[model samples]
Every structure is written in C-alpha cells, then in structure tokens.
Target: MPTSVKIFDTTLRDGTQGEGISLSVEDKIKIARKLDELGVHYIEGGWPGSNSKDIEFFERTRTMTFKNAKITAFGSTRRKDSKACDDINLNRLVDSGVQVATIFGKSWDFHVTTAIQTTLEENLNMIYDSVQFLKSKGLEVIYDAEHFFDGYKNNAEYALQTISKAQDAGADWIVLCDTNGGSLPGEIAQIVGAVKAHVSTPVGIHAHNDCELAVANSLAAVQAGAGQVQGTINGYGERCGNANLSSVIPNLQLKLGYSVLSDEQLKSLTSVSRYISEIANMHMPINQPFVGNAAFAHKGGIHVSAILKDASTYEHIKPELVGNKQRVLVSELAGQSNVLVKAQELNLDFDRDPQKSKEIIEKIKEMEHQGYQFEGADATLELILREAFEGLEEIFTLESFKMLVEKTANHAVVSEAIVKVKVHGETIYTAAEGNGPVNALDNALRKALIQYYPDIKNIHLSDYKVRVLDEKDATAGKVRVLMETTDFSSTWNTLGVSSNIIEASWYALVDSLRYALLGRTRIEREDKDQLEQLGVVNH
Candidate 1:
C-alpha cells in the first residue's frame, strides 16, 4: 500500500509573500474554498499575530465548513526573552480558533547568532517552549525547523537537537525547511534521513525554489521518509517561489504512487491551478509541467506524427488526467501531421485533401516570413482554414475607419474613432470613444455590427500583446499583435502582423469577431455541434 502523504497548502500564507501578490481577505476566502474542493489536508490561513487582515480571515472563515482540510494558523515561536505563557504570539495562536498551529523557530546556529541576535541555547528553548505552549492549548502543533538543511550541513549535531527538542515538546509534525532554497536534492535527502533517525514525530518537507529545484528536493525528502509536503499552487511565494504543488502533487501520486488527492479531485488540478492564478491576476507559465497552456502543445511535424500514433511516445502521461488537452500547433516548422491535427482540432473538414494540406503548409510558411505566427493564434488560423475550404464569404467588409487622439493642458487625453462598414450589404456608419486607439476602433466597429449580429455584444477582448519583429528597424519595424477574446466561458487567441501597429491590431480584432461570428459558441464545441445537428442555427 502506498503512503498517504498529507498535503499542506500555504498559498494564502507563504504564497502571498511573492512579489506583486496581494490578496484581499475575500480572495483568501475564495481560494480556501477552492483548496477544500481540491482536497488538501491543510490550508494555512496566515499569521493571525501579524496583522488585522489575517485575524479577519480567521474570523470570516470561522463558521465556514471544510470537508477535507483543516484551517491551520501560522506564526513564529515566542520572542527570545518572553516566556511562552506570557508571549503575545503564542496567545494569538491559541485564540485563533483553528485546531492546528504551525510555528517556526531558528534551527540554524548562524541565524540565531547573526540574524536574530540570540544565543544558540535560547533558540532551542524558543522552539521547545512554543510547541509546548501550543500543545497545552490542546491545538495540534506542527514545528517548522527553518533552515534545517543549511543548519544540518553547518552543525549536524545541533540540527538534530532542534527536532529532538520539538519532538520532546509533543509537536504533532516536524517539517524540515529548505528556507534558503540553495540546498541540492542529495543534501535534502540526507538531512531528512538524519532527522528521521533523530525523532519519532512524523516528518514533512517545505522547500523553496531559488535554485529551481524545490520540487526535486521535495521529492527527495519524501523518498527519504517525509510523509507531508508543504507548498503553494504554481509555486507562489517570496523570492523565486516555494515548491509548486501543481507539479509536486502529480509527481508524488503518479510517479511515486503516493496517495494524495483522489482520482476525481486530481483531474481538477489544471482548472484549480488556473482558478488560483486568475484570482491572483497572475499568469501561469505556459510550459509549467502537467497543467499549462503549452504543456502538451506539439509543433514539430515529426513529433506530431509520433504522438498521432502513440501519445506516450511524446507525452509522459495522459493530459486529460490533469484536465488539460493536447494542442497541435501549426507553424513554418509544422508538417502534414500538424496541419491534419490542427484542422481536426478546429473541427475543419479539409476532406484529407493532400494538395490542400501542401498548399496550406506553404501558405503558413509564407505568412511566417511576413511575421505572422499561427502557432499562438488558433482563432486566426481557423479563419484561414475557413477561407481555404469553403471560400468563406466575408461576413462584413470594412469600408474605412479613422482614429483621433486629443490632449489639452490640465485635461485628460481622449481617443475616438469613426468607422464605416457594410453588413448584410447595408452601409452602417458609427463613431465611439474609448481609452485607447485600438479600444476606440473595437468600440466603433462593434457599434456598427452588433445590430446585425447580436452575439457580437457578448464577445470582448480579454488581452492584447504586441511584439517587435525587427528591432533593428526601430520605430519603422513591423509589429505583431496577439489578442485574446473571451465570452466568460471560453477564450480564443488571434494575431496579425504589420509594420503599422494599428493595422496589426485591426487584423487580429477582425479575426476575433469572425471566429465568434462563425460559431457563436459560448459552451463546449461538442455541445455547439450537437445543437447544429439538431437544426438550431440561430443560437
């Protein structure tokens, strides 16, 4: 039987320490609920002793129900000079109303002498006193031996004594911290093994990623006897970040056969990861293992060919296991397999026309030479295929558009656009104001077209990014614009490239509208197809 490794998530606590990450108490509450749905063993609410916000967090969630996770309060040990019974930090933990308390103290002699200006003996007493005080309050205590790896390397005997003291103080769990994040995996495994020998308390590992090895070190610790893994989703924390439980959880359950989240909850990993990143207003790295936009994106023709026959040839695990799907990208580097797969993914029936595939490949190569990249712009590529296969009639034609920007002393800058378009062979003229040139154009064009296509009102641009294709040309360089549009249900990426920035934006913007116009889908593509099969065209 595999060991059930307890997952302690600190996204609300340590994760908020990451640069630019600021979560309102409401954001923390929402994240806590989602974490419960994901079935983690514990959720650290934050240090109630530090601020009013953390206290408010506990107060807000006091009556909330969680099925799988305990709300744990985080704080440091008693002050060096204060008795545990008289310490404010200790008393705050007891008053926090949470059943669990995690407290950290100096495990490294260097930190005691140089960082905290305390004697080594006093540091030991701090760890022991804090754990005992919390235990006396009938709270389950987890002692974090901060910098245990570096401390172990400096003075192995003293490092052993910290956890030994914590165990003697009746701490429920002894978690070793690689706080500096500089220790290699071997050092982590060896030190954790030594701690296992020194204590009867269950062991856990909390690793940081300064060296990009937090996940590796965490796995090493578990192999060497740790039963709990502490981390945040997408590795959010101070400095580089903490170990990413998004990667750690899958690695533990799938590779090491450790029982963590259930199979059903495991499948929600990708959605949960995206949910947190969205709420944080941060972007998850596209290549993050197991649960990123490009984790399974195959672009190489040969790679696509191999994956078509056997996904395991190119993929380590089934992407659906983590709620992500394989995406076939077409570019100048693409081959026939990429074209076929991409066409199928977009539900475009090219009828397996060999000549058509060859033509499309050449066209994409030519477009790439012009700085147009279809790989990251699926909606634009879909529009291209629609033109190729069906001789798709233009839904609307742009007659002309003009933009104006004006500024005066002691006044805000203003932007406006005038647009003329022919929809259903009827000329419509409209003008609108917006925050920027592109926004004005979008608003003006949308104003002209929404009367004909009401669903256009539902689609809105979510993101826009521009890149210089030739920096040597400087101000005259061609730029590529990528735009994302979403209907709050799904999103599509469209792009265009031109020497004129506004021209590039217009191309992407038009493709965005065209894609939405063709399908008008706000639900899954399969559902849209089912509705179409049932003769529900107006929807």
Candidate 2:
C-alpha cells in the first residue's frame, strides 16, 4: 500500500495573513471546528504568543474536542543565541496547550545572514533546540524549515545540515517549505527526492501560490516520497495564497491513488470550501478549481452537444467525487442541444419541435449578439421559454411610467416614481418614493399590483448589478442589468439588456417580481432529477 499523506491545514494561521483577511477569535474557532469535522490531520490554530486574539483562541479551544484533527499552534523558533527553555515564544507553545506545535526556523543561508543577521551555525541550533524543547513538552513537533527550497538551491550542504539537526533532535515531522513559492514542480520533486536520501525523518511540503504552482509543487513533493501536505482551504494566505487543499486533496486521493481523506470527507469538499468562504466573508472566486461555480460548467456549443450524448467526452472525473455538480449554460454560443437540454431541465414542453428549437436558438443568438446573456438569468430564460411555448399571459400591461430625482443643498437627494398599469382590464395609477430611481420604480410597480397579488409584499429585490457591454461605445454603450430577488428561503436572478440603462433596469426589475408572482411556481414543478443535474437556480 502507498504511504498515506497527512493533511495539515493552516488557514487559521497563515491564511489570515492575506490582505483583507481578518478573522476574529470566534471566526478562528468556527474554522477550527469545521476543519476538525473535515477530518484534517492537523489544524494550525494561530500563534498564541503573537497576539491576544490567538491566545484567547487557544484558551477557549483547550477544552473542545476534535475527533480526527489535532489542534496545532504556529510560531517561530527560539530567538538566536537564546536557550530554548528560557524562550517566551517556545514557552508559549507549551502554554497554548496543544498536542502539536509547529515552529519555523530559517533554512536559507541568505535569510540567516542577510535577514535574521544570525550566523549560519546558530540557525541550525535554533532548528534543533526548538524541535527538541517542544518534543520534551510531550507535544508532536512539526519543524517547518522555512525557505527550504531556496536554501537548498543556494546552499545545499547548509540546508541539508539544518533539517539534519531537526531530525537529530527528534522532530516528529520535517516539512520542507517553498517559502518563496518560486520553485517549479520539477525543481520541487528533484530537491525533495535529494533531501529524502539524507534524512530519516518523514518529509512534508508547504507550498505557496505566488507562481500559481503550489498544488503542483505539493504533488511533486509527495510523488518524491514526502508524507504530508500543508495547505489552507481555498488557498488563503499572504501573497498569492497557500496551496489550495480543496484541489490538492482531490488530486492526491482521486488522481494519484493516494489516501489523504476518507470517501465521505472527500465528498464534502465543495461544501466545505464554500462554508469557509462564507464564514470568512469572502466571495468564492467563480473559477477556482474543483470548488468554483465555473469549475465544471459547460457553455460552448460543441462541448455542450458532446456532454449531452456522454459527459465523459468532455469531463475528466465525475463532479460528484468532490461534491460539485455539472452545469450546462446557454448563450449565443449554444447549440440546438443546449436549448433542448436546458428547456427540458426547466420542464418546458418544447415537444421536440425542431423549428421551435431553431427559432429559440436564433432568438438567443441574436439577443446575445445584442449583449443579452442568459447564463446567470435562468429566471429570465424561463420567462422567454414560457412566452415562446406556453404563451403565458402577462400579469399586467404597462401603460406608462415616470421617474424624478431631486436634491436641495441642505437636504438629501430623493427619488420618486409614478406608474400606470392595466391589471385585469382595470387601469390603476400609483406613485412611490425611494432612495434611487430603480427603487422608486419597483415601489411604484408594487403599489400598482400589490392589491392583485398580496404575496408581492413578502418578496424584495436583494441585489442589483449593471454591466456595460462596450467600453469603446462610451456613454452610448449598451448595458445589462441583473436583479436578484429572494423571499429569504430561495433566491433567483433575472436579467435585462438595452442601450438605455433605465430601460434595462426596468426590464430586470419587472422580471424579478414576475418570477416571484409566476415563474417561481412553474419552475418548481420541473423534473427533479434534471433540475438537480443541470442546476435550475443560479445565484
């Protein structure tokens, strides 16, 4: 059997170093609990000696129990020329009350002389004494040889001596760090392989993503016999970020035949990635590998047409292996199959009518050429499908609408809208006030129809976005507007595009309420399996 790779997650420690990433002690505790549930081998809770917040985190979590993960503390090695036993940082490791302690010491000769101003011999002693002192405290010691790769390239003999000292001092894990994150996969493999012959200690890799090669470097290290992989969820860290464990675990377990996570834990990868992003208050990048919204999305005509016949023609692995699902997107780039597949998934009765399919595809292509994209507007797409095939009657016919924005020197700007509409052949005129023209329009429309559809009071537009299609067109550029609406339980997106920004906002605003009134009921009755597979709701 192949050696099992240990996963050490450092999101709470190294990850928070990234710009705009600030987690409170409560957030750190939440992440630690989730990482424990993720079955990671170790969770590097922050450095207790460095800050009051981390000290509080260690104190609070000292009594909490984790089934699979050992809570670990991160800190630097004892200061130069100091005995490990007398060091405040080292003693804080013992004080942090964790079973495992990870201490990093400089490995690069350049950092030793130029950065730390320490003699080469003392750096080695720092590595040795720190690991030994922690081991003496009955804590599992993970000695991170900071800048190990750069150190090896610049002074191979000295770098080898540093870890040799840690190994001699009984460090439980000797992890090689690509601190600069500049080493390529081949260099990583070659260096780790060379170091393997010199040390009897189990090896590990800690890679960053400055060059976007952290995952590759980690895998290369493992392939060369490293036993552990240290990374953070979603690659959160300083600089480019740390190696993304969401991608690394799957690559090791599924692609490379390595055992890193259990089958059930592996299946929870996508949700875990998003859950952390939510708690961290960061939007998960849509294109992030494996866990991103676009990771398995297909939009091109040829790809969609092929995947419909056999998904294997395009996809490499079943998306469910990492808890992600395959999504088919429709646009001007779509083929007839894209229309047919998405329509069926939404339970639209196209009835296999080739001409109807052709006409719909043509309309979509024409609209996309005019800057209308259906990719994020499934609600709007449903409205189009209903109008074409079902001939669904309009909820209300708009007669006319007017908006006014006014400001006085001493008072805040105010917006008001007047709307007229014929509901069930009875014309109604109403007006409303709002902070913006779009809000005012939405209010006036609601005022016009609230009596007919009392449920409209329960729904509100939660998000509104506008994108200019052509920069060169300048002020005349066509604009696209997307409105996100929710009743708190479920949310959906609607879209509209036109050269007139107000017109675009009007269309999307109207569709959002129309979906709340009509399309929501119709979309819910679709085939469950198809909806689940193709993804009916996009937010």
Candidate 3:
C-alpha cells in the first residue's frame, strides 16, 4: 500500500479571509458537505468564538454527518495570561463538538516578543498547556506553529522549541506554517526536514501563495516527510491565497504516487471547484491548473492535429481522469483536424465528408477574422455545422418583431414587444410586457411558440453577456451577444453579432430556443424508434 497523505482543507476558516469572501452559516455547511464528498481527510471549520455566524455554523453542523472527513474547529492557543482550561477560545472549541481541534500559537520570537508581548517561555507554556488541555478533553490536537518558516530562519532553536513543547504535550500533529507565504520550495524542504528530525510527532504543512509557491512548497514538504497537507479549494484565502487542494491532490496522487483521495473521489475535483465558485458567486478561473476550463483545450493547428491522433501528444494527462474533457477550440488558428474533432464532439458526422469539414474550418476562420468568436459559443457552432452538413432545417421562422418602450411624465417606464413567427407554415403573433425591452421580446417570442412546442417553457436563459467588437468605433461598432440557456438536462451557449445590440440579442435568443427544441425533437424521435423496435408501433 502507498503512503496516505492526509488532506486538510481550511476553505471555511482561512478561505473566507480573502477579500470579498463571506460565507453564511448555510453556505459553510453546504461547502463542508461538498468537501466531505470530495474525500478530504480534515475540514477546519471557522473559529467558534470569533463571530456569531461561525458559531452558528458549528452549531448547525453538529448534527450533520460526514462520511470521510473529520470536522476540526480552528482557533488560537490560550491568551497571554489565561490558563488553558479557563481560556474562552479553548472553551468554544470544546463546545463546537468537533472531534479534532487545531490551534495556532506564535512560533516566531518576534511575534512572541512584539505581537503577543509575552515572554518566550510563556508562549511555549501556552502551546504545551493548550494542546494538553485539548487532548485531555478527548479531542485530537493539531498544533499549528504559526510563522514557523520565518521563525526558523530567524531563530531555529526557539522555533524548534515551540514545536517540541507541543510534541511533549501529546500533540497528534505539529504543523509548520509558512504563514507569511515568503519561503521558497527549497527552504520549505530544508526546514521541514529539520523539523522531522527534531520532533517525533507527525508533521504537516500549511502554505500560502505570496510567491506563487504554495503548491510547490507543499509538495516539497510532503517529500520531506510531512504526512499532512493543508490548503483550500481553488486556493481561496487571505493575501495571495493558500495552496490549491485541487492542484495538490492530483500532484500527490498521480505524480508523486502518494494516495490522498481515491481515484473515484478525485474525479469530482473539477466539479467541486466549480460548485464552490458558484456558491461564492465568483467567476471560475478558466486558466487554473488541473481543474480549469482551458486545462485540456487545444487550438493551434499543429497541436490540434497531433492531439486528434493521440491526446497524450499535447496533454499531460487524460482530462477525463480529472472530470474534464478535451476541447478542440475553433478559432482562426484551427485546422481541419480542429473542425473534425469539434464536429465529432457535437455528434456531427463529418468523417465521411471531408469537404464539409474543410468548409467549417474555412467558415470559422472567416468569422473569427470578422471578430465573431465561436470558442465560447459551442451551441452556435454546432448549429452552423448541422445546417451545413446535416441539413438541419429551421424549427421556426421569425417573420417580424417590434419592441416598444414608453416613459410617462410620472417617470414610470413600460416596455412591450410583439413577435410574429411561422411554425409549420402557420403564422402566430404574440405580445407581452416586461421590465425591459429584452425581457419583453423574450416573453413575446416564447409565448408565440409555446402552443406549438410546449417544451420551450422548460428552456430559460440563465446568463446573457454582451461585448463591443470595436470600442474605437463606439456607437458604430458591432456588438456580440452570448446567451446561456438550460432545459434541466444540460446548458448550452448561443451567440449573435450585429451593429444593433437588440438585433444581436434577438438572434442569440432565437438560436437558444431552436437548439433546445432540436434536442427535444431528437429525444422524441429516439423514443419512437425504441417503441418500433419493441413492435409496439409501426411507421
């Protein structure tokens, strides 16, 4: 069996320290459950005594059962003059009802002398008393030597003494923290190796990313006999953020041969990263390592050609292994292989018709030169390809549309739109009012087609983004509209470009509806085919 390195996720406690990150109690619980599902060994819940929301989180999560991760409450050691048993922070950790307690104390002499204004001996006493008190309470104690790296560099003997005190007090794990996040990977390895030699207790590492070396330093610590790794999902934390567990886990499991999470649990890494980002209402970094959107995306002609032959030619690892897929992005740099790969991914048959593939490649290059980006709008690209090769017919034809906006003297504005559509050669006209012209237009168009295709009601636009093609041209510049729609089954993006923003938005909206209707039609046809196969119906 391979060595198992424990994964300690501090997203709830340390991650919220990042700017603009505020997690409600409910959000904390949701994230805890998700982290549990992702197979983290330990989850550091926030300081119970620091705030009411964190207190509430501990209270609510007391009843919630986690499968693999043990909930750990985080806090500092006993205060300057307080005994461990009488410390309010230590009492809150006990009341939090977590099985593990992780407490930090000043390891650096500078912090002990200046920040805490306490004697070096008293800080050592604090570490010993706190860990022993927690251990006496039937709670596992993990002592965090705050600023351990900086402290070790300044006074190695005193820094080693702090960890030694915790180890003597029966600390289960003594974690060396690069709290300042200034140490490089080589320095981390040397310090961790020295600590391993000095302390008998199991060692762990907590790294920050001020130098973009958090992940590197973490892996280095592991190589130097640190049994536990502490980080956050997506590297969320204060300053530059902590080491990203999404990157660390894979590096340990796949690259270093250390088992952190099971292969099956590791597959959820990308989804878990995205889920946290969604809950935080933050944009997922498309270029983040391992779990990012562009992790396995190929665009260059030579790269795409080689990747199509064998994915490993350009990719470091199979994307599906990390819950991601290889994306052959269509752009001006795309070649015939890029078109073929993208077409195949969309379930379009272009293998037998090489001419159609060339046409798509040419068309994409031309559109890209005209400032029409298709990389982010796969649904639009699929529609164009289907129309060219599969002979996809228009589900509905737009006859005409008119939008009206009226503002009265009282300052109340009313927006209404009327849409005319031809479905199966029958003309339908519908009008609707909304808070804005775009909403009104969307309502009117959907109302016109609802009777003919009731499934259109299930499809609703989730996101709409508009960008100016050329800012120098100002009002004369063309606008690109991207619409993301979902029908409970899947989400897809459609795009349109025009000088008029309304026209561009209308075009994207229409394509979104048509794409959804096309999916419904295909499913219905498949259902009919299955029935015919069972001899229940005849064509």
Q: What number of backbone clashes does candidate 2 have, counting pairs of residues 3 or more apart or in separate chains?
A: 0
Please write out the lDDT profile of model 1 over residues 347-410, one tens digit for every residue: 7776757799789999998999999988789889988887887566577999999999999998
- For candidate 3, write residues 1-539 as lDDT tens digits: 11889999999999999988998888999999999999999999999879999889888889889999999999899998789999999999998999999999998999999999999999999999999999999999999999999999999999999999999999999999999999999999999999988988999999999999999999999999999999999999999999999999999998999988888899999999999998877788888888998888888989999987888899998887778877888899988888888777768788788887887788889888776788888898888888888777568898999999999999889999999989999999899998888889999999988888998888888998999999999999999999999986789999988999889999899889888888778789889999989888855
Q: Is candidate 2 or candidate 3 better by TM-score?
A: 3
List the candidates ranked by TM-score, beginning with the highest. 3, 1, 2
Determine the C-alpha RMSD for candidate 3 after optimal superposition of all C-alphas: 1.8
Largest lDDT belongs to which candidate?
1
Residue 509 of model 3 has an lDDT of: 92
RMSD to the native, candidate 1? Answer: 2.5
Give lDDT tens digits, candidate 2, residues 346-414: 787777577988898999999889888888888888888778887776789899999899999999999
**Candidate 1: what lDDT?**
0.92
What is the overall TM-score of model 2 with all chains considered together?
A: 0.92
Lowest lDDT 10-residue stretch of candidate 1: 519-528
Best by TM-score, which number?
3
Q: lDDT, candidate 1, residue 22?
A: 94
